[model samples]
Target: MTTKTGDQESPLASQVDPQTSVSRVPPPETPAAVQTRFRVIAAFWAVIIFLGFPIWWKTTSIYRASLPLEEMVHWADGKTCRPVFPLEIHLSTPSLPYIEAQHLLRTTQHTLDDLNEFAAHHLRLKLANDTTGDHTGQDSSEHVNYAARETPDTALTVRLLPQEGLASPRSELHAATTQLDVFYPPSQIPVSSSSNSPLSTFIAAELQQLYGEEKATIAHILSGDTARLASTSPQLAEDISRRLRRSMKYAETYHLSFSLFTPGAEPSSWDIEAAVNEYVSPLLQALSPISNFTVDTQVQLYANFAPTAPKPEYDESEAVWTLKKEGLSAFVNAAEWPLNPSIGTGPTINFILYVPDPSQSPLVVKENSASSWIVPQWGGVFLLNPPLSNDEQGSRSNPAHLSLGSLGPAFMTFSHQLLTLLGTPSTPASLPLRLQTSIRIRAATLLLSASSTMGSLARLTESLPSIPIPATVATSVSTTLSHLTATCSHLREGRFGAALASARVAETEAERSFFEKSMVGQVYFPDEHKVAVYLPLLGPIGVPLVVGLLRELKRIAAKRKAKAS
Candidate 1:
């Protein structure tokens, strides 16, 4: 019903107007919609913070061992200790009066100082009053293995003998003992007043010459610069390089593998144990102070070269069966040689006695016809061509039997080659002296190598923080640090064998820690993978939630402004 007129009153203002119908549809359930939208967002954020964040943190963090990083850096920086060689010299003069002996010792020390070029390694002379003190000192030094030098720790004992030599002083180096027999011409004895003399210089030069090779080697190692030898000579530098290249990496125990390889089946059997005892064992025994050698012998027959390897060609110029110098390295036929290292901790040094077939006897280097060459940190090979004939069993000839006696030359050559490979010096006629020098060289080498390794480990950790540092790696680092300390201490004590053993352990541990497989596998997720996994889920779920939140925020801001107005 339409009412009278100033305005038409619809019976229902309560009835929906067309404009109101368009405008008010349950107010679009705004508050409930907002609360639902908020709950959904809060749930998503909770999952992201609690689930995603922890997973990312746990996955990315490095398992850093409680390493003494400060101490390690300190050691690497050379702040830990300055290695000094305070060598003790026990001067025992039973014949000379005590006062005279002391005087002689003082003069000799002055002479030694005058000759010494290296300040780190020096001789401290202490006059021994009694024979028992010398023995006791030696035993205690060996047992306790103290780093500090005390009495009876002399490297060499000079026995002053008045001999019938006419012209000058003479020195005899004892092969067994660390004794130098210094015979002064009776006319040349130092009277109470002489401050300088020719005899002293002569003795100094002789001793210097004896230790010269070792000094150069140690210098080469310490400086890490062979170019220092350019001032000496290019030839000397080349010689130094050759020596270093041939020398094996230092180890506590060296596996001395004696392999008898033949192109043909004959000469398969050798009296190896006896040959080793006679030809090799003595030298190894002489080497005992430097390293422990475990010897194992095997005979590999029918060992042939790879097909791609250059075949041995007869050299008319040399008039012998020759292997080209280029292929000489491959001549060993390593794939076929059964020269596996003896089972042990130290590296294996192989000594191969390759007996060529009767047809190929007298094999020589195509370039030099040299019978021997080194395999560089491995071993040496000597082509043995025993007088050939087709007469005996297991032999193409009578020499095939090759009694333990026959191996004498081959093994002797091998022993020499082995010494070279083991970093034994050629100078200083005394074998014991050479071995001792070898010990010092090895200790220096290991020390440097281990230090460099630590530096590498530190750098690696710094570069890759995401990698997992397992407890094993921590244990390994600790082991390395401890062994390195032990090695340094042993070197100071002049217990070279113990030092080498410790160094070997340190190297192994350092390698193990550095190459931890688990640590290497982090930071490797591909970009393609991240895109493949997250994009699909995030894109679909993110749009509506973002729009709803924006709308609710705008509506709340407008209501607050209107209420304030």
Candidate 2:
């Protein structure tokens, strides 16, 4: 075994290798190339920061309009307006002289002031001229007739007459008009020396009695505390609460629908036009100043009761068919009844005149044995058991055409129900006076409702930071505030009609603001969802850019270190 020298082994190794036996090492990159690469990276980052990021942000951001948040909150807090009622009562004393009448007016006002406890609602008395064609107190009847006409801003008229037959002072309130007839003995008239007299005391007490329920109701509505109102009786408070609950919400208009429903087919035609024209048209006209009403009537046959409704049973003792009181609630078959609300902005009031089948004639509510009942806010129902037609087989059948006379009682009941549903006070025995009361009640209700809506909107905005309020909501808020202010001014100036109109607008605007569609709609995107959606695109593009940036920064740091060394 001979070991070869290292030089000779290297020659053999070189011959064994391929033709290219030499390995070459490349030179370092030039500064121009390094600067070009760094510039490319910098340009990419600049585009991302200036253009790409802004586009993404603009596309994803929500659009929120500017709002007067502070002003809205203030209005909601009831800091914007306070409501006050100043009722003007006109005194027409045709019997007394001018000086005596003025003295009586002053004394009565003083008496009323002393008796009244609630300051917000107080009465003001003004004397109406008793000049009815010459002699005073000579034509008392003519004077009363003249005074009954529509007096401007007048709530009530007092007609004083001196009667020789009267033992004591007597007061009679007119059921039709806002007039009070006071018949007194001539001796009871107030003299100049007497500050307090029997006549003044009587008038004061009468006025107090007239407005007692109204004052309590106003107080309850304003404060919502019945216990604090001293004049409110338990029964009165319960009545007020029931009326409020049963009454329909205040509206600018109401659609009154008179429908005749029957289980059989005989009573298909009715004198509805005549009935509405005679009985309902007058009432609707009377209520026109408060709310506009559209009258429509219909007749529906083959209308059956719901399955859940209790079946009417024959009362052998009373000889009539009767339905249980609790079952009256289900008398109207809501599922099958064609009682859809009228096409309008306001609500529809349905007056259902149900005529039971001849077999179930004389149907009445079991508890009260009554033929009429109110559905509380919805409308009213009247069971009319028309006399059956006589036939050879003695089979019972309703008449084909109902007369105007037959519909009188039903329509009257409907009118009363309409009044109740409109939140009219039960007292005062005057339609005009009751309407005025309704105006005040409706105004108060609208004001409070708007205030509550404003507060709710404010709280909602505070609670939900993500919801984007549209400019419409701000516009609605501003309108509501302006109308509320106008309403307060109208009430103060005794323009109740205008006040009601303003309150209606305020309520409508507040509701619009609170229930704004855009403000209510909010699409919530969770952080996890955001990450899931963005990660796929960002992950692919971000890693390379970040790594390149970090590597470039490290290289620059190393260069600085070398230069320092």
lDDT to native, each model = 0.73, 0.85
**lDDT of predicted model 1:** 0.73
Best by TM-score: 2
Give Cα distance to truth, residue 98, candidate 1, Å.
1.9
lDDT of 2 by residue, 194-255 (tens): 79889899999999989888888888888886777666789989998888899998788898
Query: TM-scores, in order shown?
Result: 0.81, 0.87
lDDT of 1 by residue, 1-565 (tens): 5544557666655466679667755646668777887688767768878998799779745567666666666666666644445456566666677766666777777998977777656667676664433444456647455334332245666676766755878878897777778777666666668765665566666666766677677777777555643233566656776889878877667888888777677786888888888878888788776667887778887777767788878766656898888897777776656667546767988888888777776787778888778899888888877877766465454255678667788888998898888878887777777777776777777776776777777777777665567899889888988988987886676555667678778887888888888877665854467679878978887787678667767877998999999
Per-residue error (Å), model 1, residue 280: 2.5
**With candidate 1 superimposed using the best TM-score fit, by how many Å does residue 543's alpha carbon deviate from the native?**
5.5
lDDT of 2: 0.85
Superposed on all Cα atoms, the candidates' RMSDs to the truth, in angstroms, are: 5.6, 6.5
